[model samples]
Target: AQLFFISNGLSVGFASIQTLTDKSTGLKKGIKGDLTTLRPTIMTAVPLILDRIQNAIESTINKSRFARIFFAIFFSQKKFWSYYGLDTPLINLIFCRKFKAALGGRVKIIACGGAPLSPETHQFIRNCFDLKLLQGYGLTETSASATIMSLDDTSVGFVGQPLDGIQIKLIDWEEGNYKVTDKPNPRGEIVIGGHNVTNGYYKNETLTKESYKEENGVKWFLTGDIGEMFPNGSLKIIDRKKDIIKLSTGEYISLAKIEAELKKCPFIANVCVYGDSSKEYVIAFIIPNASHLKSLADKLSKSGLSFKELCNDSEITAGVLQSIRQIAKHSKLHKVEIPNKIKLCSEEWLPENNLVTSALKLRRKNIQDFYQKDIHLMYGNEHKP
Candidate 1:
């Protein structure tokens, strides 16, 4: 496969594929490392890594106030002219040269999988790299990719139709109250059936039975992934079935959706939104963008606090929370959807620390347990409901 795969390297059997492996710990090396090392033309990475690469590039340009403003104006118009492919020449002349040097100027395709990629970030990478970013969708039980975007697909958020042999369908999930009848698009639990789909678990009959269903002689796998089918025949993953929690008021909340919207704020590096039947409202644990926080502190004449101390400063804390609210507002989130409480943390979640999955997804239960004290404080010690 000539694909540069970035992952924990334990999951998925891509080790034998011809690929470039990062010697260091992060996706940042993709931007900082010499691409001449492998002369890679294709890359497969999680959306988190792609976001990190975008942030790194933006940060580098932000170092120069003039360059920052220059890009701000350029991209503002690029967003309009991009539809006609008029933005490429200027972008190549100004930014692509430096970026190309880092990657040996040979990258033609980047396949993103493992997590939901925001449309904005997807487009940013496309505009910057001037390459096709194919997004793939699947689960471990489905073998690998059940669906993949076409090489010509530049649209984001949608993972496109299923593979040739894969048969995909949606069924209503009562717990989530999601159905195909609800709106501009149809959404429900995605079910997959095909030769590529596993028949059953080796010895775990209970799980195998619960996860599979027979329909017209085909054993369909219940993917537990909620998705929306578009008029264009594309599929957009909405949230995981397990990630949806019902509040004490009986309102269903998708933690994944909330976290995705919160992460949209430039000041937020990472965030995990939590709520359960015991809680009346949502709460968030946030890891701030250190550089962005520092810039904010400098602008406010509070640079003395430092990134760690700034997390505890009342004013800085308030500012970060407000930025999150603004981002939520821009996303048209309901008042109930906005987090009622938020806790700031300085440490970034990493696979090494087990705070994140190999795919870079947050370990929600572990995070909640680790912040039990803070969570308790947020919902008063005596308020257990």
Candidate 2:
């Protein structure tokens, strides 16, 4: 049986902060792993948790009452889910059990970052584990975190407002315009200004000049992420500028976000999405999380479904599509934002394989470069639809 339970949130509420470290972020501020004693009053996570919960609905629901219960989450955290542009934040806490024990048995707030926190993950963790996860946003240039939701008064996925002394604005940056002024909150690159922000990339002045600019009486560092400011002054991140992938159909895509979702699959450890306008469809190379893969096998057998048969079945492929569709619906993403193709494999995207960072983050550009030919073939005609 696929067992689920509530563990203490603080245990992991700040325990496994593996994703906090950035290599270019300099050694002092960068994290090699989760902080044990130096517990964060608030911790952030990605949207992958919500992503796996969505996949679980299709892959192993088994017509049980649990099917309806699990599916119900898609509609519940609507606003919360849309906060990070990946609407399924509720489910992020489904498998985050180990965290329950490690938090020195005490914690303050859980900050869901990277992507959006689904409403399910937020409310579920709060009610079940007694841990409140507040969604927030920031970037590397801003030194990892720029703004956080107020713990005393927080809503699911709001990302709250900006921090004290930090500045933000929107600009008219549509290729033709380089020297333009500010806009309140249009969907342009999120620009930042604050002491916390990095001065510039080490030895990369031109790139820095292109990224940093003066706006609204302060020097602002440009983050390639696309976002909007609410009239209430809260900030929400939606997508990345570098992630604007144009498909073969001339449809622009966000493979970065797409791959991030796939990585959320409990079964997924590493994933890479590749497709250009020269390609009919985008393709992914996935490395499954071993434990999650085993759980899949268990879930299949208990449900009287053949793992082997389902693995190769067209129904399985279609199920993957439906799961992704539900995620897109929950996330409130555009049509081109979704990825239609995936290549699932039991092998992990290992650090030794150069597919992951030492901290186990997927190196997207590296993965594509190394497996360029294989990725092309997966999106090719030979594979069964």
Candidate 3:
């Protein structure tokens, strides 16, 4: 992105995470701080960064009862007008301007990629900032360009249509029961064929042949990502082929999908859902949001405990599990899809720890190995619903 901007004669500035989040440096200049100093009109970020911004804004708003009430009323009003293809400038000026100022007050666009942004966060950003928060979909093999949401698109959850010269096709996955012939919307594995697709993996002919193919003289890359096509030509990624696991009851669950949904819960910062074919239920390893965990501890009258102790408190664990179940139900997950047990941890999974990738994607095998004991203990007392 920086190269593209520079090639186009646009000036680009970079800021490290330390520069942005370091309280000593940022707070010294006032609330807006370095971002306000930059005053950037356009920004690009991953879903993780965007999620943090959303969480921070929510945390600030929730600190005051009147602020929460004011935000709720205006948010609804703005959302209502947005549905009719209208803008509430008054609401933006009065209610959202303060929130927008935290990001420099000049941010006109935010492009999000790397991971799927939850529908709730997507809408929250759009309404709160009153700016274009475009969600995009792509992989490194495609040179990081594929589908990007249009600025005029008001819908949430869909990644939008393909880019110019990019062609997409969906093939049925029989084992997963995703079909291109499904009613209302065609669902299947996404395959990309275009000039942007890579020729092959270097010195790995077997993997290259398995994932890449030529049909009708066009090279295609099988994404292994399940998608549903809308009547308007938009695409919504629904699952991942590699993330599907079957339970003892013969029901298949998409771990990626469930994790995405559960992350919407305020208590959860990150989670890994695990299913055993020998068991009828699933279990999860959760990394709790530190601020939210502290709040939870306060609510349970268990304040002053260390982070590790808070994680192990039986009441707190049970409370968090209840909250997770509530969020899963709200997300319309099946009964079996809701994890039967969860083990909360104070330690975050990071690339440095080898529990997650640099892109923040879970290194499933590493995470499982790291928490094998917790997994066993949770499953030992598992009961089928």
Candidate 3 Cα outliers beyond 4 Å, as residue runs: 16-34, 381-385
Give one digit per residue, the lDDT tens place, for model 3 in 1-385: 8988999998787754334542323255444445666877898777776777787778778999998898889999988898677978889889879778877788889898877888888898888988898989999888888899999999999898999999999999999999999988999999999899998899999999999999888889999999999999899988998899998899999999899889888888788998887898988999887789899999999999999999999999999999999999989999999999899988878778999877778898898889887877888855322
Evaluate model 1: give its TM-score. 0.86
Better of 1 and 2 by TM-score: 1
lDDT for 34 in candidate 3 is 57
CA lDDT scores, all candidates in order? 0.78, 0.56, 0.85
Off by over 4 Å in 2: 1-105, 115-120, 175-185, 215-217, 257-270, 289-340, 350-354, 357-361, 381-385
Ranking by lDDT: 3, 1, 2
TM-score on alpha carbons, each prediction: 0.86, 0.64, 0.92
Alpha carbon lDDT of residue 151, candidate 1? 74
- Model 3 error, position 74 (Å): 0.8
lDDT of 2 by residue, 270-297 (tens): 5667765666567666655434444555
Give lDDT: candidate 3, residue 363. 91
Report the number of the highest-TM-score candidate: 3
